[model samples]
Target: MKNYLILAAGLAFAAPAATAQSTASATGAAAAPISAGQRKAAEELLAATDSEKNLSATIDRMLSAQLEQNPGMKAVEPEMRAYLTKYMSWPSMKEDMVQLYAREFTEKELRELTKFYQTPTGRKTITKMPELMAAGMEIGQKRMQEHLPELQQAIAEKLKSQPPGAVK
Candidate 1:
């Protein structure tokens, strides 16, 4: 149950953007405040990319995939959907997402990205991202499953080498 909830939250919040992590300080002490122009550019970029539609599609795909993998979860599917839609829908998250982009990117960068997203290639990227992400995840899962035994073995070896209670 906890895992499902976590998965739901992760899926709902996952941005299908550049897939890069921010290098900002953990405490955000080094972060600069977002300017109004930056925020506006972020909003325009999101609009050009149809982020809301992509978000909805991503959530639907994630839920359907989860249900397919765990038939027993079907009973709670409606609740899961409702919870995600109520709390994490595009309307609810748009401002925060805009802030995120605004903080991570400069106003000029955002404007350039917005322009790119208005082009044919950029439009294709937006439309194809959900499917591309799904395929990428499938590949990653397959690779992880294949190597899981090696990871387990490495952990077991490290634990054996450690002094008793040292890990704690």
Candidate 2:
């Protein structure tokens, strides 16, 4: 449950925009203040990334694949769709993200960021990010696989050492 909550929180707040973290920290909450121009720039940058549209497509593909793999999931498909639609809809994520940007960055920085994202390099970065993240996750999975047996052994040892009451 803890892990699920953590994952849910992470997913809930996760902006699809790769630059959002950097963009937020660029100015920070304590820095001067944001201006209208900066807000506009942030909006532009967000628009350029098209994170919501891309994420929506990716999620749809994921759900479709999941359904294809396990037809039994059809029993809960409507509930799952409702949950995602209510909480993870593009509009909800975008609105939360805009507020986050406004809180994090100065107006000037946001505008500059918008300009940066408009360039060819920026566009390329946007297009390649999903692949990059997927590859990174694969690497992490492989590393975990290499150590999983050792981890399981350690857990077994810990469980064996624990008192019967502690075991439960």
| Candidate number with greatest lDDT | 1
lDDT of 2 by residue, 68-166 (tens): 766777777677667677777777667556656766667776767777777999889878876786688679899999999999999999999998889
Candidate 1, lDDT over the whole model: 0.80
Error of 1 at 31 (Å): 5.9
* TM match of model 2 to true structure: 0.71
Worst 10 residues of 2 by lDDT: 1-10
Off by over 4 Å in 2: 1-14, 17-38
Residues 1-168, candidate 1: write the lDDT tens digits. 975876666684466532333333345555567888888999999999888987887788778878888889999988988988987689887876787788778999999999998999999988887778778978999999999999999999999999999987
Question: Tell me, what's the RMSD of every candidate?
Answer: 2.4, 5.1
Most TM-score-accurate candidate? 1
Clashing pairs in 1: none
Clashes within 3 Å, all models in order: 0, 1
